[model samples]
Target chain A: MTSPLQQKLKINGSSVVTANRTWDGIVVYRTAAKGWSADLAEAAIVRTPDEAKALLAEAVADDVGAIGPYIAPVQVDDTGKILPGNLREQIRRDGVTIDLPV
Target chain B: MYAYDEIDRTLVNERVSEFRDQVKRRLSGELTEDEFKMLRLQNGVYLQLHAYMFRVAIPYGTLASNQLRQLAHVARKYDRGYGHFTTRQNIQFNWIKLSDLPDALADLAEVGIHAMQTSGNNMRNVTSDQWAGVAPGEIEDPRIWSELIRQHTTLHPEFSFLPRKFKIAITASDHDRAAIKVHDIGLRLIKNEKGETGFEVLVGGGLGRTPFIGKTIKHFVHGRDLLSYIEAILRVYNQYGRRDNIYKARIKILVHELGIEKFSREVEEEWQQIRHSSLQIDDEVIEDIRSRFIYPSYEKLPHMPDELRQAAADPDFEAWRKNSVAAHKNPGYAIVTISLKPIGAPPGDATAEQMDALADLADKYSFGEIRVGHEQNLALPHVAKRDLPALWKALDKLGLATPNVNLITDIIACPGLDYCSLANARSIPIAQELTRRFANHELANLIGRLHINISGCINACGHHHVGHIGILGVEKNGEEVYQITIGGRADESAALGNLIGPGVKFHEVADVIEDIVEAYLALRERPDELFVDTVKRLGVEPFKERVYATR
Candidate 1:
């Protein structure tokens, strides 16, 4: 019976803070329910999103097999809103968002 | 022109063979890719996205017609029928194969040219004023010192791998068209207190992540001690400059961390150690390099001509004279800049035929010599004033006759995400769009002396940070977007531009730029005020309001 905010807090993944900052994986923030919001960091302020996803595709491929495709299915909420974890997909889905360390 | 003696010829021939063998070893797999990359880069070879690029040095932007003919031959034989003249006064062929590089080197060597140090983190081809010999306002021809530095720094054993890539620009004129401020070292040849000619050396200036106007380290370093002083500076940098982080490796950052006074003291301490050594430029060596740069004997022509007076009466010729031609040292001669930025085209691209036409123009008018400016434009530095009409006719046919040298339309754009692998978005299209949006030559001339630079990424190959109106392209939501910064300059007074507000979408960029221009027009004190001076007088608030009105 954990809330979405609590779930995000529990994930312990890297957070995108700004476009200038570096991120290990693709950082996505859901703006509203079913609306993905990317984290944007100004000079000092950090705005968190409804949902965040870091695609584990590169890490998975390195760990497992290159021939076999790996997918990191990320859910914003429990209502079947899933996002791809690959860097290219994140770039396609969300234009330019801040990436801050969690 | 300095004819190559046996020593010069032998050195070039031997270096060509050495590079030829290096290429052979690379192809045979005896040298690893990493090992061969440095070797090839040292020989001016780069593996660009599509093919191997060979960059040939046009020393201080000076070249002979025979040398250019040789380049044209290489373009026809080995490359894609054209060569890209870069910002460093070097020509790059982007389609050369790895196998044919040696042959290309051999061809270049035949004309006393080599691809040496055109790439790599070495002392690159020394760039000076493209109008060095013919400039009327200059203190002296800087090519003499440029050639001296080229010999002194080329493969100097003690200072090869210092900090990062080092660039040096020398200028004798009051105006710094060579962009002396953006280099690691900027040497200005000036008259000293004792009425002696020497260099007022500036160090720690560059434009990348952290842009800086170089500080004057020495008030006056004697001309004879140029080599010794430069060696001292490099040796000091080599010892203590950061090597761990690539971003912080430039001598500017080193000079930033250690204050200018401290840095200069260290350099002076090092100079004292090496003052009287072999590196100290002797009187004989200076004279030898000086003799090489003396201009050819003139025909003792008249200062003014009636043909020029007639051409001045013609309106089209008058506009071309005002825009294209400059006063030269010789009375009957003029330095004509062939504008490569035709409307809706890349800034510095001359077609294969245009190259031939330029070569022909050089041979016919400019004493069989051609010069390439740092802004990617070609110059007929010694064109006779009487021949301006004929030169205009030839250039007009080739589409090389845009009369906007320092106007708003003459944008300095890099081969952005289109061709370069490191580009985040396309830069050429933005330039083309802007050119089309502001197609009025009169309007462009009205907004005089504004530099617009675009770089796709932050590596800053295009020098976007220093542009008067700088645009940096980044990707946003699978689409191209450009961020605008205003009020940057790269002349003697170099300043990094201030960011206006947010990134504009690719489609809105042209409109935003139009609005910015309109704002400048409304608030300007006079019509003659430049964009930089006006921006300085009135702050960026008006520009920001105009740019972000609809946001």
Candidate 2:
């Protein structure tokens, strides 16, 4: 069972922004898609390489009016400098662009 | 006496600009009150009930004459002609306006002072022994490590927002003058088996609603790796510490819940990852910082002057000598404590004129060196014993010659509901009433050595919990109630006080205290029976019965 903080971290968009990083949790991605609020059932948690690819695909699909490709990870090193590891950079390279409804 | 070089100057200048921009943006309503609140707090700006307060850091409680003068100028110009020295070895100007904060920071920067990390969850002002360099028993100056901590923690990106606010205190001497046991991180410099000095570090100690004496986490942390070790501890705290509940957020709670062995092992594990990194003490950097704290060359002098000998023979000087003077490292010199606790005046308060006079006297008698202790008292740490009479005469004219150093009337009280936003009752008026209650010097001397610390709230701003006779002011319904605790101590054997039944009404508090003191007088073990010893022998039962006879 996940706590509200964990559930909140699981959702990339909606009111819950990325809180902090954990060693083995899904890195959240905020969606630009309108009318798409994160329900607990819809939240993603990836553990495998296939699941990671699926998460990136879902995030790109949800970027209808692509506001950002901001990767929100839970943890970082002691320097407070953000780390973009291989997985994160691979996701960033597959960024999508979407036009917003005026 | 640490002097700022180019890096220090540049950092302070950049911070000034950042604060200036923050102020402009705040005033323009570009940021919300909450956002700006955190920002201002990060810079040590507190909005009290009446007005904004600017708490400036007096690092390790040492101040040059020029810094003292600059603080005085700020009091005269920015504040309402006075600043309050706090328990953390910081000075606070209570009446600063929101708009004037930038100007105040600029003025402070001119004297190499700032409010940075004086508040917030980051490392607060690194405090050490106020009598750091001059104390006779000091192995080495703790101010060196204090400065190193100050530099290492300043704007450290990783540790800015931790579980709760972190406080570090250092003591170079065997005596715990810095109150090391009650701080978050307490370091005592000790000579190890290798005949080299290093720090014995204690962690997880603080006093508020929940007080815990710090535990020794590390038996010996060498002079190097101080920064990285601290960083590792902070990172562990930041990552796993409770953020949902503010009360359980302090590292003490973590240490308590996880057990010290586990907590310490975790910290050690984290420290192993970053042990000898760039965060370790760079020799060049240490040398650069250490060079600033080197003592100024003093002229060699004889053991004692004839004038000092004659004054020591005088009766009045004899009394002052017994009370106000401390042993000096330099012969023919003494540390003079100018008691702010006058017969009728508020303790720890010096009017603007009094501050100026003290600054002048510092320049005249004490080799321009001044130190403000955690007890809100000022010390001229290097006064020539021969100039005692001259110094006494000058101080007498300024109304600062109270001759009540550590006496019963030297009450430590907080700025209560009158100024503080978190206060439940007024502390200054109670302190004043008690001062007038015990007006006679003979009576005060008769009571012997008793420390009465009164706090308006449970925040322990006045450090009431550690007083020999602690009074905590709480609000019952709409009226103020005073709770009395006996046998509390803040000395080498510091202990939390035991509560004496329920609290007394505000009007009857003075009378109740008088009754308690009377109880002490009647239960005389002897004339030399200090309050703590009596309380220790008889326990708090006698005082409790006297205080709450009708309850």
Candidate 3:
């Protein structure tokens, strides 16, 4: 939570709070249930400044397992699902952009 | 092929235990993330894009079979079942859990391998020529000096931290296989007119946001004076290298800022004081390190047995031999390059199964030794010519025999935006697509020796600046695009490539490369003129025109 991304984000649309789980370094998002979820679709999307601040605060307050929390923009498709708004976050939501042998 | 002594084992094991305690504290919140970051990086654990990345040093690109098997075990047990061989002659395992790092370090220590200083702003893993002792016409084996440097620089209290990371590479041959011209410090073994061996020392070469070819600081330093001379350079750099701007912290910037003359004057002043100090290498110690080298027992035999030549009549076997195999210093022996660049797979990646199988093959065919070169490929440094057909077939089954050494598809690339946190765009997909586009397809074989390197960002970990054709990922607007360069070469005559034409979108990169190849083919006066040589001869004017003509 003390990472450089702790600074404010200039959001144009809806956003979500995201971080990597400390022990495993897995990407996770702040969920509507006030907990972390590994899936970005389950992330709590916020549109307003106040909503974004409250949701990111929830992430920053949790230091036990979450680290380097930051706000990233997201978009909602017609199906009412959260989609990462940028290539970087989308790849973080998915795995690597290309096929790599496991 | 250096075996770990008791001291080396104890040092690694003790550090492993100490790091386990540090990780426990970090996880329990007794230590802060900022403090723990330095500790973890010193141990070669990096928090990357999706998961933690653990980098392990493969000393001078040499590995014993059992050591490789241990790596396979770690890859299978702690990671995503594969290890990425980097251009630095190191192996990295992505997707390792932060908590699993301590256990992984312990496991690797059993094989006399540790990831120490593979990251951090300290002296990194010292790399050398892959075919050091086996290659014909090398002035002398450079691994001896590499090992000496490894011991001197590892945990040297004076240089525990520096303005930025430092890298050193030593190559013994005239061909400069180590890419020494672009390293922080390059040491080339040479003989003076007095018939005594010495080193031609070059300093301040590096590749990053700023690229520089190293300039020779000293023409010849006596073999015994190498460590002192190098240490003096480090001392000067540690004092005068920039610390304000992260972009300018490398020694190359300092040398550039002060000009090479002033930098040389500073280094000379410091070296004269330390020339006769305890850092001077003694013959006994060099001999001790040299004696530890696991030299293979060879049978005096004929060169390229008639059988291998006959087998070369088969196109598949012949192509692999001519391209993927190199002449060895020993008669009837071959240095087989087991390329990790498959047609569509990630360059420099080996699955656990492949690692285990390659270990077996190395033990059976190449004196239980394997080497990883800076080109992101693995080499079996000593293989009998007779066993090559079987080796190629086995490698083919493992999906490693791509037969494209020094070919266009034998690319050197970094784990770009896909894994690195600093990348502006993804590099692997571009590399994968280019490989699928060019490897052994169309006139790729006819294109002859060409090198293509890609980097995700300006950090240039992929050595993109020296590629015959370099593709660098950049962001234009909101989408990913690539900036291509032509005519770079990483060799004895190292030169940075010039940017050609405008940057193109990711989807068009493969075609753009095809056009560049086509332009080279058309522009060259003879088929024998290499793509790099053609560019060198004609400059980038014609290729620039050809690539951007339709745009």
Candidate 4:
């Protein structure tokens, strides 16, 4: 059985492009300014499948700094704020919710 | 511990430089991810779910206090404040940066530690009985042989890129503490009728998607020809082992397909040509290695100390002493297993402060020596019996004195979906929940010796295959489910667990285990019979019936 992550990729959703920085392996989101940012709040929001695909393509084109570019589902609140739409993405954005020693 | 010679130091430093260059090339995109993956893996750097995970080998499960302190330094300096020790007797840092791995490797080399062969399709760090030299029933120290194998397998040219990863375990005692039967090659040190030391070699035992107990390939192989015999087995495996299917590539599969009789004949034929070659180690070489592991200077003392007798009066100290201490070979000393599976904490994880504290305790109590057991606990092998109360208090201060060794709460779990990319579900949380459920010391003591092992996936890193009560996590319809197994044993009579019925949902797992234990409590013939013994005697039917019964 395939895992949720291994299922067919769907571009049709409110999404933000994400990838890991090549050297440091930190998760980064495609920002509205056409660059990668560590903060998900600064991520460029895409409402349509086409917009998600375009942002993912742009992230892929900027491969010099990142790897494994994919579009992750995010919620756009009434205030136009972005938050992870699922638990997995929330974990990726906020680095292991379990309490860990510093 | 074998002190690093000039040659070892030079080779380690050279490896650090090479890895640094490889990382630099990878960052510059001169090497693609596919090309760099093998290089990084060989150096024990794995790209996990969130970040790069760095693993360092604790060769033969032996470490000096200073070396452990150095590891703590790396944990605090290069990673988060804690590190997770793995079932392979290696420690891993979850959050490692690719850019800092070279420096980390360099720092590790400074303490005579290395990541080489910790991963990749090479012979991994040769493991042995954790109490190799100190165990009472030992015929010979297995660490010497493990060390010899480590030297031979390190960067071995011919076997470097085999069909799959190979693991070899050696044990000198009759008790199978090293889990030799489940390894690719299980070497048991034995003696012949002539009183000559030799090895009883078993081949092709492994746990993964397919679990099989190893079969005896050779009744005995003399110590001098051990390496050549092993090399022969590897040669036979490399030539015929499947490379097309990664699942069928392990030597265990090859032996299973070829049959042990035919496999033994083939290895015997191959060994005839190489038996007298330079690979045959001499008695002097063995003695040299053995000489390096001489016993630490122990002051002569009476067998029983008055302080220990007085301390045994306290129930808490007595409980801790009974569960944590083991009989050492020396009359006045004991082997103390420091449990890493604290209540509510992740199994096998030690904070940097805890690591430093243990190091201090090792120096004060043991002879500055620490051993990492396959069960994910650290051991001070040379602690004087008189110092038990002091050691217990010190351990209590560091939160390491959990007298739950071999109990239900002492779980062996892999870093599952939370960290490992290969995991289908989470293992740590399951272990945590079970530990929390059985947190009461008296309740756990009532349950008695129960090994509850959990694996995140079929890879079986948590050794669920051999647990008395095994929990394997699986993904079902995008949800986490757990499969339970019963009657598995990793001892002299090693056997794989029998699967109970369907997988249980995450929430129902702890309750299911509680039900099974409750049934055991009702069905057991005597208080002395262990959980594994009861399951073995009565079979999995009773437990299966109870587990799958209606609510």
Candidate 5:
């Protein structure tokens, strides 16, 4: 069985546009409503390469809200939920997995 | 510790205001990401995987109690509830927001601390002997000179934009507590036959993709000529160091390409032209430098009081005192090393409450001063011998008395993929796993003085190249694996570790370490031989053979 991190790394066609929010450096995704959201569920998923490029371009033009916008490979689950495609992105999405001091 | 003067105060305050304006411009879409990155980096801000990591200097690992409380305040106000102490002895806030940075800098500056040149390609915070003024068999305090270098290097106009980041480490003792040999420029204070304090200078040493033990260029530099000589070396590096290749741009590469003898000649030539100029330090300047520093007042008590022996009656206190306490130059005092590595917590992390508690304890017992060791541990360098029992009980309550200094579980690891953006795999989890696997105190005591360091990439931020047992994280195919090295040490005789064999899976790291430990126990010449010594007596092949054959 593959590790959870390895499983996340195996992308199957789905992608999304993501960036860090400009004010606080929080990870945010380009939403289908032409805005940004911290939740991956509200992200605008693009399966085709051209669609990913267009979505990335739209995110880049909205640089006033975020920084370093780029297209990232994502994975679609059986329940139609979007998951981050790699461990780095997954970490950015869910925060640090380990227990940090409060 | 050196207090900030008027000029220093102005510069820091100006930088804070400048950063506020730049941050405003960035939010308003006036400055692009590329344009604002260098500015933020100069102020010790870097974007990590989760958020912006703001690094603040401890200035040669020395901190006052109130200064430490200010760090705790920053931790509570601007960052998460904790801060990570880095291998360089600086503190890093891993979850700071960009919007809160200007206020954070201003607040930190009020306590005479700023993050200037903490992250940029400028001379970084100078690291020195943690037991600088108090250690036995020491010359003059190294902090006086470390502070001098710190003053000279902060926003130095000529040396600001060097080829790459430079690090300097200094020591005043024969024993290498500062690991000076692994630095870009290592300064060792030695007394001549005439009994004058001078420096033995070593140049061009570094770690990362390339690691070199610093080569001594000058046998002795007079106290007054120290700054002149250092400036000459930096001038030569600024003129000749490679700029086209970022990977090969450090002074180590330049020194390697030029050969040490030729590099020495160039530095000498530069020194001759500028030695007597305004950069030269006179006796008055040295006196001024000495006057700027604050020294602890020793009470002049007898060595090893009866209360110390009485306190040692408990076996648990005995264990902690043996591992965590060291002899002080002054009698009736001991340097107490507080272990930041609790069994399951991150290696160098301290929560805000813990920081506040430790700072107050430091004020009450350790003369209101604390020193951060390069090994990611904190030290109360001037604790009275009489206070051992009380200090130990307090520390035990705080969960900082782990009795694992220099033991197997006291691991040195970088933030890696958890916080750093440049890591290939996660290193903290590997360190955590190893720490948990070796949680047995008896087993840890038996397998003593093993330095296990982990880095996620070739950057060697964890100083893995010099660890007795080094682990480097890399991704194979899609999953993470770790490469192990044996026999490396960072000391007066610093040497890089050699790779043992192929990379191992993350779950297999603990087993691999245990096998190596068992093999060393079986193969060592005597029970007292260090693991590095055993690996040296017999090369990596013996340990390699045992590990691979067993697996």
Candidate 6:
């Protein structure tokens, strides 16, 4: 696939590609299977800049289902699990930060 | 409440159909995101941080019981079973789906409510005093003029595009509950020395990034020439208002750049030509609109009912009566304000169940009508004094019996970082924390008539600039920091708050406010003195000293 560098975002550390589903506006992360999933656990973690660029490219290429694809910082634990690095990303991953009526 | 006429119904239905087609084209990729953004915004669809939020106007904050029931139905069917009432007398659904927006609009249209002009740089929903007709010491009902302005501004070809969004508020009472001084245009109905009711027109007041108290351009404009005078002001702003920068595009900026004298002169020069045109309101038309808002049939009863007297002996009912009820024009009746700011719950939020119950209460106690106050509370404008005890019991069952009107806990907050895409910090959590800190009703009552407003960003969606205690959220080095302002009041003596000191961390905000309130308590001459009055008496220096003492 031809990589479009213009859509590339500045990345500092371990990250995952994320976008919002266009239909429902839910946050979704790119998975290792080259598809979007709502669950952050299924997100494909990239440790290096090149890996993040490739994942972002895959996310942007799937434009039919999502909007505003970008790489977001993630933290990896000793168990090799991923979590959003910042409060905004964490809130996005886990719906509203406060309690909301279901 | 003004019922939708045939023209209004046709216009709403047509707009919904147009939006439905636009959504279809956007989904099919026939239109780019840039092309669809404006169209969606005009339809009141905002793409926020988590999802789409849809804002529906409650025209002049008046709603029929059936109309409110329809809103509840829309919440249950399309959204997440709840809606957030906004400071601008509107209701917003936070978790709306882009795909379901068209269907939602159509459903809302069936009840004569729409989301038109709620977003975009157009005349937004005209807000007015929540207790428009019921409040005593009034010249006339402001909602009549609010509805007239709504009709004139709706889909007006000339003002559909302006330098920035415009807002207008009308208040007939001298108390000024509508925050008229902070609106783009404030119309106050006042009687002349000759007993003729006219409007004192104030212009160019707004709060976003640049806050200014509106200046009275015309001391009194005849009620007949109200529309022409407004049109003249809008024309001047349209021609000379800055369009280059979004931040400096409000009429307030124009009035600031060119002094109010020069701006008033220009508006006068423009009004000289159009003052006698068709825009001059006819007396008969005014009377026609007035006739529609006739008082509901009231029974001839004594001022104090026996049941109310007996309930006043009960401490619980007396507590509710102290905070939740207000004096009405009719001696036998009172205005009831329902608190939406329950402890630990988001301000202005109502579940579908709560909304339905409120509607049923309106049918039973009120005259099948409800009003949304600018403070994000619901009011039953005309409830008999005898029915208050039963109403309080019913509201208690629904967890809506919090008696904190104008108290420290009755906070006004905007959906900040949690939902809004443009927010720099979160407002809801701070409000919740402050509410928890002041959960004691006795302490809150001791602090009498304190208004705490929180905005997530500089946009001032929460009217923080005019709050008795204003908290603004800002981002510093990627972390949220809150700045506090003191002594802002939204009444007749409207004044902007003064920034006390440096920004505090989110965890310190509640403590800072507590210190400020404690200082006010210590300094007040008597218990009857309000916090705002105390701040006015003792300058911001004392409050600032107490707040930053620990820093």
Native A-B interface contacts kept, per candidate? 0.00, 0.00, 0.75, 0.41, 0.61, 0.51
TM per prediction: 0.84, 0.82, 0.97, 0.94, 0.96, 0.95
State the lDDT at B398 in candidate 4. 88
| TM-score winner | 3
Off-target runs (Cα >4 Å) in candidate 2 are: A1-102, B282-285
TM-score of 5: 0.96
Error of 4 at B122 (Å): 1.0
TM-score rank order: 3, 5, 6, 4, 1, 2
**Poorly placed runs, candidate 5 (over 4 Å):** A1-12
In Å, residue B298's CA in model 2 sits off its true spot by 2.9
Tell me how far the alpha carbon of residue A67 in candidate 1 is from the true structure, in angstroms, after superposition.
Answer: 21
Q: Judging by lDDT, tell me the better candidate of 1 and 6.
A: 6
Q: Against the true chain A, what TM-score does chain A of candidate 2 give? A: 0.28
Ranking by lDDT: 6, 4, 3, 5, 2, 1
Candidate 3, residues A3-102, lDDT tens digits: the string is 4435655777989989889999999999999899998878999898778888888787777678778888899999898898889888888889777787
| Model with the higher TM-score, candidate 2 or 6 | 6
Candidate 3, what DockQ?
0.74
Measured by DockQ, the strongest candidate is 3
Question: Can you write out model 4's per-residue Cα lDDT over A12-73, one digit (the tens) per residue?
Answer: 46888888888888889999888999999999988776677677778777766777777788
**Residue B36, model 5: Cα distance from true site in angstroms:** 1.1
All DockQ scores: 0.03, 0.01, 0.74, 0.44, 0.55, 0.51
lDDT for B147 in candidate 2 is 92
Please give the ranking of all candidate structures by DockQ, highest first, separated by commas: 3, 5, 6, 4, 1, 2
Question: What value of lDDT does candidate 5 attain over all alpha carbons?
Answer: 0.89
Error of 4 at B308 (Å): 0.6
Recovered share of real interface contacts in candidate 3: 0.75
